[model samples]
Target: MPFQHPKETGYGHVIERYVTRKDSDHPRYLELGSRRVLRPGWPHAERFTRHLIDDAAAITDVELEALLAYEWRSRLTAAWLIGVDQRTSFRERIGDLLLASEVCYSGGGYCFALARLGTHADAEILTAYLDRYLPRTDLRYDQPEALGALLRLDAHLGTQHADRFTEPDGLWDQWVQALAHLQDSPDYTPAEQRRWTDLHCDFASGWARP
Candidate 1:
């Protein structure tokens, strides 16, 4: 089947389908992620997030865990948008389903979501993703999204680049340090955060360039 961006939301909002592909090589094992997101410019974005948050709050602990594990990447940022710090299994469930989720399997665009919930295992997953979906060859080079996310996570965790993900030239180390500085500081304002996110979205969208 041709890959389609269905306009379904957690609620009943109708979104225009995102750009679709005709003969995509979708992963056979695609697992679902957080259903919090709506169409990119949907008018009901806030309502969608609120609905999911309320739905999450009313569910049993089991359901909440599923909600958190459902990060369509960004660790499913909306959950935290409403402050899931006190929600059941917030940390425990985040990224727990990576091995089973098809988010990264789809392509580099989805892999971009890894940074929000970045972990050691996710780093490994991206490494493998690059190898499989964007691998390098003497005559072929793939522009992988793995770099940006890896750099951001290294900063978030305040750590040097992991050896497995590192290239021999130490470029990853310098890049990670620079990205860490750009991270939201104690004084970073909400407006600044929005700008940063907008910039990120631009860069991420460009990753679609072939």
Candidate 2:
């Protein structure tokens, strides 16, 4: 959607107004509740999220739900927005948002959002979900993308379930290929490789340390 400031003032009002804006030829505008405002493009997503952080108090449960329900592509945008909002206090609040549902638009966006938030106390909660929900044959194409997000988060947050990736299945190859493409350059961190090694010991172990 084309960028347009809300006619109304205040972060909440601005988000609310944006939500109500009629869909145009561009991507749809999403009103994620009183505190959250989402535009179609990644740039606009960043801008809108910055606006929300400026007025964090306005964030509400309704907006969180809207974010969770967001489609996968949009969820990635939402993830970026949330990552920018990283705050210790927001951990509990964001965890509450994820608690509402498990079946969401699973994509790179959703993965990042969950991973970013997973760095907080909420990480424990999501770790459980990740342990239980991950490694499925379904979403095989998307598994690498999801695993990349999880590995990054595990690296940052130190998840106990890091070893889950080390399974002998082709998951490691998938992870290597996925990480190579998902990131700008094919570089893996020690922590990142730890998760990879846990999944594919031979492949990760053989690689020289970066």
Candidate 3:
């Protein structure tokens, strides 16, 4: 059989456990894929990218299922997880740290492994996260890697993708386009992982539009 769209598979139903935040007895679900990432003893966790790869693999054969299957955290985690999982380089591996960042917020991490793989283009995965879910108020997600990925993109591409951080304009359409040097990129303010700077709130609230 072919790889079915999630809508067609049994595992898709299992994945829907995360998607709908629902649970079942026979369908084998993590029920907490994102939460499982937070455990102190998560295997291979010393390596953030690998851990995400493992976590995502544990969920489904097709990584995109994890992308499609859930609460935004699992989805965002899936973004980083799949990004690193897909990298074909091994020379990039280094010591473990807070990529490890999303759930824990412990900070103090070395380089982002995905970025190290020279996959600045992979920011598209996280871009999907922002584009897909940022407008809603129901789900909560964490993306320490997102901020790191943006910086890595800046370094790699000589572009300054907007900051959903200290500046309201980083995520603004103008800079995201300038950074990609494309006619367009996903343009909007994301509420996740922000510390509520007045400028950030202004962008989110539409009080400060550019």
- Considering every candidate listed, which one attains the maximal lDDT? 2
lDDT of 1 at 128: 52
How much does each candidate deviate from the true structure in C-alpha RMSD? Answer: 13.0, 11.7, 14.5
lDDT of each: 0.35, 0.41, 0.36
**Model 2: number of clashes?**
4
Q: What stretches of model 2 exceed 4 Å from their correct place?
A: 1-58, 65-81, 87-110, 118-122, 140-146, 157-160, 167-210
**Where does the lowest 10-residue lDDT sum fall in candidate 1?**
14-23
**What tens-digit string does per-residue lDDT give for candidate 2 at 1-210?**
222232322233434332333333233233332112222353444444444344333444345335434433333334444543443444543444343333343333333445545554544645544444344424323343345545655666766444555454434444444544543333333344335324322221222223
lDDT of 3 by residue, 13-128 (tens): 43443333322322112322333434456563334323233443455445444333433343433333333344333212211122222333211111233343445444444444
Which pairs clash in model 1?
A: 31-102, 34-70
Point out the higher-scoring one by lDDT: 1 or 3.
3
Model 2 TM-score is 0.43
